[model samples]
Target chain A: MFQPHADRIAKPLLAAAALVCAAVLVLIIAVIISGAWPALISQDLVVFITDASWYPLEGQFGMLSMLLASLLVMMIAILLAAPMGIICAIFIAYIAPVRVQKIYRFAIALLAGMPSVVLGLWGLTVLVPLVNKWSPPGLSLLLAGIVLAVMILPTVALTSLAAFKSLPIALQQAASALGVRQHVQILKVFIPAASAAILSGMLLAMARALGETMVVLMVAGNVVQFPSGLMEPVRTLTANIALEMAYATDQHRAALFVSGLLLTAMVLVMMSFAARIKGHNDYG
Target chain B: MAEHLFQFVIWCVALLVLMVLLWLVYGLLDHGLAKLSFEFLLSEPQNAGRDGGIISILVATLLILAVTLLAALPLGLASAVWLAEFTATHHFWARKVRLALDVMAGVPSIVFGLFGYAFFGIFMGMGFSVLSGGLTLACMILPVFIRTCEIGLRGVNNSWRQGAAALGMPKIKAVWYILLPAAMPAISAGLILGIGRATAETAALMFTSGYVDRMPESVMDSGRALSVHIYDLSMNVTGGDAAAQASALLLLMIIIVLNMLAYAVTDLWLGRRLSNDLA
Candidate 1:
């Protein structure tokens, strides 16, 4: 017979541990919001969003440009990565031989696991130079977009592959039996069936691209300007935080926290939206 | 003709994805290999990071990793166990916990850095030390570890639990002896993944663990992490590319080795489990 004392101790201990895990997210939110409280109260919310200039030293903390830069880069990343990722996923799911599929999956996993810093290093040393040849400064919105696309490609591809693989085999068999061509089936049936999951994956990728710091900081040129063109250098909100958090003081520090707060809120929103789509796919 | 072209496009995209991975590895190796030496691994730096071995940085990295694992593993394991066994899938609290973990997982590393700076470095007065950085990383990686571990735990056959109950085994004992052992491969895989994440982190560690490139005498001392060192070398220091590339190579190697170890552990454990079932 089991000792009653053991259950008494183990249950509460495990519960406490779980509570601790949940508390971490709350703690992070609280700290960031509290740190950002100064800017949130002092800076006019309207002006903060409307102002394009970000001269923090001169008391100007307009983050509208950085915010736009973040969104623009993320959009570019998704635009470039989504179709390619879906295609890559389809190739893995339907075209590759079984052994080759395994190898490809492993390679994709390796890519997914690649550190952002290393990718940034590569972008800086190799990609930036190549980009610079076309444009005077290599670090541009376009460059950041490319690096971010590569960063998120694995995420999109893997999730899409899983989505495709999860399709009932009967669907494919029935399609072929009814004289539907493979490409047609993929375009008409398979992708639609997996659309929810694939869409959610892209959303997650967007969130990642939006929040990415090192790659953008290294390759986005950290220029606080509205990117008039793809080749123009721009600073993202994340890059702004990383570049200034060191010497930043008082309201400047608080302003950086506001950037962090904004990023966290955006990511949290996307994550929940993705989770909802995933939940619907699982149940509905 | 259209179908063939479509297929060709897909193939090209796949190849391009593979090429990107190869290009990254090739780029690092091409620039880094000549600089990677035993002496480089064992020595300290001279004139910033331009002329030194990565011994101090390595030590700091290891210490930070140790602190992260030490802080995270117990919490993660317990959280995973509770989620997998104690709570029903549809329970409100369980759903809330899962939601929290998911949101945490999606929060960016830079956000984590800001939180760490605010809470640990300033509020707690840990102030840019290994303890602060490691704790911050522990928080960041907790969701990953817990989710993976929970999946592994849930993947254990329901029959095993039923059989254990039929044999009059205590729940705690059964979990410790049967469930945990069966989940070791997954737990270790999660561990390795978390290690890779923690070690490769730059933004989270940059302000929390600090950018001091000296020998850290204690966890309280600010020390540079390998990833941050690489960032600084490549971005800040003039003529620091050689050491930076070498450091990147080292970090990449560490990640690769950990990944291989994870695979090996999974294979070995799963192989034994298969044989046991057959027996």
Candidate 2:
């Protein structure tokens, strides 16, 4: 039934079609670098990246503060989300009734699907104000981190759930055979066994939190200063890029591209690291 | 005592997430849903989106969705078919393609926005039009489409393929006529989820589609999307919070409906297969 000529054509055609994703990846990096070249070449790359000031009018484009804010806020977000996510995963995987488990799963999926902008709007209107009542200005690092924590919760929870669900049946049986109580088995046996997967989930969520734009953009206050406290407003690398890209010109445009490059590189590193550390027992 | 304490902590943590979820949904409905009306849905914004409605922005959002699906569908399906059917699971190029897709998925939306602005808007001379935003969005959602279509194609049973082969059917014909139809539901389910994603995206569209309030006369016209509309109102417009909240309610309702539809479709598909097995 196969035509020889058609076979030759189809194979190449399909291969070329499949290559589009790879091609697009290459194009994105190349385009971004080329766009950023004007700034990268003229300015001292080290000083431009290391200095804390970001005066675009005078062309003082240091991203040190924003970078620090991005890392600091991401760390804060992961700290808040990871424990909750892991515990939530534990509840869903082992404790919840089957019917409750189904509902929780659906709820988490719906939560994940909720747009970031809407969440940002909520953060701006509700969370920021709430934080402000206690902490003077509400749109600060703390508010951004809290919003991010909420945003990335489902990512961590879902991954941790998959990780726990894949725990070997024998391990649970062994713990039970040894006459361990349910809580003890979970703490000593299940948690220890699922730790690698839990760590993997944390890392993935860290990557997501780091890359998340809208929620933090709306609530993070977009100040390019070093965050001395969680109550102080901070600008993230992502917020910096998004806030400036539209009106940025000449050196400013290139500087934004440079930050874009940095953001892309940071995310890719986290992804690769997550991929590397991912537990093999997942999907087992 | 230690075990009880730990259990309490775990329960509290779990309940926290559930509480947050409920609070968000309930708060949006209470604060924003009251403001929503059919007039609000069908009219254009007045006073920088602080008042009136969101009909134009909704149309722009739908237009972007159309262009995104148009650009994404054929290429995504073809690649998914390639990954699922033609190549070894661990083939070098196949793995590379998969890796690229994974990396692409992780890249921040803002980066895509920059790329869209530089490549499509400036270099390609589209200049923040719906066409540019749509193409960028197409790229952004491509991984979702490919991954979903791949799963659907893989779900087509191996026995069916063997049966077709035994009947001396060409591989292409079998895939086209049998596998494609069998996987259509799952593929469409993926599309629904992708729609949720595309609808929610804001950063990527901010630069690629300039936030003009009017209905796009052509794909080349710049326009605001629902998410972008909400962002603009929240940031720039005074007393825009009310309008933003109202738009948020509509956006949330739309997303929840899409997700529910996706769940229902997948469930229905599985239920049908189970019943057929019993028969």
Candidate 3:
């Protein structure tokens, strides 16, 4: 039972295995930065980021347009999906019978399981064409955002459902005793209590939308311009890397890595925001 | 009236989401079902994936999954075991490690593709081969497996561990003999979920695995995966729609089956645990 020698080796082996998990994050950022070094060395970071014209061939490596496009789509998608996802979560959690709830949960999991490429294909063949008759050349920021909303709906719904479910049963009972209707109980008690988690869930989904590549690459038209309207095509940081990484060389290749660096940066920032809100909820 | 109206609206949104999901599955089936045949499943593609079946890519996908599991499973389980059994819940470094895993989970698959390109494809001189793709996939899925296994380990009742200790059992033996067997169902579910993720992934394999539509003779050889084949056909190949849809349908079917299995196993585990608790 008291095998000191075996314990010595076993502890370090397990510790090293755990350390590998931590080391991976460090290695990923280091690799990305080294790959992006050439682009970062040549340009002023602010001007490079703020300039809207991204002519990589002509040495103008600005990503303002794509950055804006990523932001615009993320904002619109969250705005569209959050309320619906929360409502659906409420339905599954409260309104549905146990059997029906199981079906709804399975359906959402299936939706979540659908690969991004297949979802992109669906967007291209179905949503884009449908959007085209009303708007010329259906592939646009709006289309991408809509597809993104669909992709992220289950994440938001499932997270929010957990948040809603975590509320103390006494809170619901007390509200009911005070003659609060079911909707009023949800609106006044559950929503208020779960707002932080719901917001954090939405932001987590936003982070996902920002990093998502295939759907936007297929439907966002990959145009390197600021989206003037919903109908206009736009590019994203992810799409920029995916489109150019194949044939790009030297500085151009580094520039694509820089776009990747920017994308990672943006997603990390969004995730930190989500973590902060979630942390606050855990403590308070 | 207002309360009823609010309830009605929630129901409508829920139904609408379900309908949209159904429509997508239907569209994929309708577009690809007619073309699906055993020949399509077993034969190699012709004319750059525009004319024939998806045999090579399907084989490549399975190979990649096998390789990913080989690398990820042991490392992930060891890490999860360390976190759950060796350390206290609030241990400082353990918390930091957990945070890092969480952050890694949020990093996009595309970035992992870039990492594979840099670290494995170029630096390691693997050069867009299945080995590079599989290693990158291992990194991407390690976080998922660790999270699941850690939760599973935590869900084991403390009484079992206490009983082991009271019997003067060695720590490693106790974990290996008692805890791990109990957690196998959940860990197996995690493995299935990891397979599903690897199967669905497109961006991560884009640069790491070469997009050649042939069977890989070795781990060093470049190959096409079903997900990547779908992307390549739809975007680059003219008249590739039918082939792409076929590939998508196959990918969809595999993912659905894996996910359903994971759900079923998890439910079974939970039911058993609940009954045990009552007893």
Question: Clashes in model 1: which pairs?
Answer: B45-B52
In Å, residue B100's CA in model 3 sits off its true spot by: 1.2
* DockQ per candidate, 2 decimals: 0.66, 0.61, 0.67
- Candidate 1 predicts chain B with a TM-score of 0.94
Winning model by TM-score: 3
User: Worst ten-residue run, lDDT, model 1 chain B?
Assistant: B270-279
lDDT: worst 10-residue window of model 3 chain A: A275-284
Lowest lDDT 10-residue stretch of candidate 2 chain A: A275-284
Tens-digit per-residue lDDT, B42-148, candidate 2: 99888888888999999999999999999888888888888887787878898888878888988898999999998999999999799999999989998888898
lDDT of 1 by residue, B94-154 (tens): 7788878888999999999999988999999999899999999999999999998998898
Give candidate 2 regions above 4 Å deviation: A1-8, A279-284, B1-4, B269-279
Query: TM-score of model 1, chain A?
Result: 0.96
lDDT of 3 by residue, B43-160 (tens): 9999988888998998888888888999999899999999998887778778888888888998899999999999999999999899999999999999889999998888887888
Number of clashes recorded per candidate: 1, 0, 0
Residues A216-242 of candidate 3: C-alpha lDDT, one tens digit per residue: 998899989978998999998898888
Question: For each of the candidates, what fraction of the native contacts does it recover?
Answer: 0.71, 0.69, 0.69
Clashing pairs in 3: none
